[model samples]
Target: MDLILIRHPAVNIDAGICYGATDVPLLCDAAESARILGERLLALNVPPVKGGWHTSPLSRCRLLAEAIGHVHVDARLQELNFGSWEKRRWDGLDRALLDTWAADLDHSRAHGGESVAQLALRVSSWIDEISRDGRPVHAITHAGVIRVLTGQLLGVPRANVIQWPLDFGAIVWLRRVRGEWLLVRWNA
Candidate 1:
C-alpha cells in the first residue's frame, strides 16, 4: 500500500509561534497551493490514491484537502497538542522547561502537551489501521504528525525524527509491503 502524507501550506501565524493543534488558517491561497501540489505529484508519477484522501480536522489542512478533491476529516490526524504553548512564541517559554523537554524527547510533557511517544503511538495506530485495508492512502496533515508517522514507519528514534525538516506543503511518500514499510520519497 502506498501512503502519501502532505503537510499543510504556510499558516497565517507569525513566525516562531507555537501553533500546534491551534486550528489556524492558511497563508497561501488554498486552491493555488493545491493546484501546484497536484502538478508536482503528477510530475512524480503519483496519481490520486485508490481510497479517498484524508485530512486533519484543522482548517489549515481541510481547506487544502477540499481544494484538491474529496476527503474525510480525522481528528487523529490533527497536529500535536501544544497545550499551554499554543500561540506563544517558543523563545518566550521558560528556558528550563524547554531544556527538560529536550532532554527527555520521548516522555517529557514539559510544555503540558502530548509527549513524543504519545504522538507516535496514535500515529502508529492510524498507520496500522489503514495498512490493513491494503489500499493506497493520502493524508493532508501537519508537519508534526507527518514526522511522527514517518518516524514510526521507519523505526527512527524520536530524537532523530526532529532532525527531519518538513517544509510547508511538503509530501512524504511511503509504501508498506509484506508488513514492512519503505520510504519511497520525502519532502517532495
Candidate 2:
C-alpha cells in the first residue's frame, strides 16, 4: 500500500507569523503552486481529487484537493492544534522558550499548545487507521503533521525531522513492502 502525503501550499498569513491550524487562506502564489502540484500528480496517474482516498480536513487542504478534483475531509488528518500560538508571530516569542523547545522537542509546547508526543500520538493513530485498509491513500496536511508521520515511519527523532525540509505542496510517498514501511520518495 502507498501513502502519499503533501503539505498545504503557502498561506496568506503574515510573513513572520505562525498560523498552525488557524484556517488561513492560501496566498496567490500558493494557488499557483497548488495548480502546478496538481498537474504533476495528474501526470503521475494520481491526479488531485481523483475519487480515490485522497483526503484532508484543513481548509487549504480542501481547496487544493477540490482543485485537483476526489478528496474527502477527514478530521483525523487535521493539523496539530497550536492553542495560544495560533495566529501569532514567531519572531515575538520568548527566546528562552524557543531555545528550550529547540533543545527538547519531545516535551516542548507553545504556550497553551500541544507537545511533540501529543502530535505523534495523533498522527500515529491516523496512520494506523489508514494502514489497516491496506490501500493507497493520499493525504494533504500541514508540514508539522508530515514531519511527525515521517519521523514515525523512518524511526527518526522528532527534533531532527525538520531537517528533512518539506517544501510547500511537495509530495512524499511512503510504501509498505512485505509488512515493512519504507520511504519510496520524498519531496517529489
Candidate 3:
C-alpha cells in the first residue's frame, strides 16, 4: 500500500516562526498552496488512489486538507504539543533552555509540554493505526511529525526527532513491501 505524507502549507506566522502545535490559522495563500499540493498528488499516479485528504487538528493543516477535498481531523495526528512555549518566538527563548532540551529531547519538557517519548508514543500509535488499514493513505501534518515518523521508520538513533528535514508543504512517500518498510520518494 502507498502512504503519502504531506506537510501543511506555508504559514505566515509572522517572521515565519516555529508555531509547533499552537492551533494557528493558515495564511491567505492557503488556497494556492492547496492547489499546488493537489497537482503534485495527482502527479504521483498511484494505483487505487483517490482524491487528496488527511490533516491534523490545526487550521493550517485542516484547511489544506479540505482544499484537496476529503479530510479527516485526527487528534492523534496533531503536531507535538509545545505547551507553554506555544506561540513564543524562538529568538525570545533562553539559549540554555533550548540547549538543555536539545541534549535530552526524549526527557525534556517545554514547561507544560510533552517529552519526546510521549510524542513518539502518539506517532507510533498513528503509524500502527495506518499500517493496519493497508491502503493508500494521505496524511498532512507538521514538520516535526514528519521527522519523527521518518526517523522511526528509518530506525535512526536520534532522540530529538529533528534529524530528518521536513519543510513546509514537502511530500514524502512510504510503503510496506512484504512487511518491510521502504521510503519511496520525497519532495523538498
Candidate 4:
C-alpha cells in the first residue's frame, strides 16, 4: 500500500503560541498551495489517487484538501489536542506543567488532551483501515500526525521521530511493499 501525506499550509498563528487542535486559518491561499503541490507531485511522477484526498477535519487541512480534489474529512486525522493550551502562549504557560509534560512526553496528558501513545493508537487505527483495502491513499494532515505515522511505519525511535523537520506544505510519500515499509519522496 502507498500513502501520500502532505502537511497543511503555514498557519497565521505566532511561533510561541500553542495551537494544536484549534482550527486555524492558513497564511496563504489554499488553492495556490494546491496548484504548486500538484505540480510537484507530477514532477515526482506520483499520479493522483482515484479515491481522492482524505484529510483532517481542521480547516487548515480540509481547505487545502478541497482545493486539490474531493475530500473525506476524518477527525482521527486531526492534530493532537492541546486542550487548555489551545491558544495560549507557550512561554506564559505554567513552568510546572511544561516540565511535567517534558518529564513524560509519551504518557503525560498534562495539558488535558491526548498523550503520544493515544495519538499513535488513533492514527494507527485510521491507517490500518486504509491499508485493508490495499489502495493508494492520499491525505493532508498535521505534522504531529505525520510524525506518528512515519515513526510507526519506519521503526524509528520515537524521540528521533519527534525531531523530524517536516515543513508546512511538505509532501511525504511512503509505501509498504513486500512486507517492508519504504520512505520515498520525503523532502518533496
Where does the lowest 10-residue lDDT sum fall in candidate 1? 44-53
Over 1-188, each residue of candidate 2 has an lDDT whose tens digit, in order, gives: 77889888877777988777778888755456666986777776652332444555677787877666566777766776767767878888878878877777777784668777888887888888777867787888888888888989888887788678788888888888898789877887
Q: What is the lDDT of candidate 3?
A: 0.76
Q: Local error of candidate 1 at 149, Å?
A: 1.0
lDDT of 4 by residue, 98-181 (tens): 999988878999999889889999999999888888788999999999988999999986778888898998899998998888
Model 4 quality (TM-score): 0.96
- Residue 157 lDDT in candidate 1: 76
Strongest candidate by lDDT: 4
| Off by more than 4 A, model 1 | none
lDDT of 2 at 93: 85
TM-score of each: 0.96, 0.87, 0.89, 0.96
Question: How many steric overlaps are in each model, in order?
Answer: 0, 3, 0, 0
Model 3, span 1-188: residue lDDT tens: 77778888767678735577787777666778877876776677644445546678888888887776777788777887777777887788878888878878887885468777787789889888866768788888987777777778867755644756677788888887888778887654
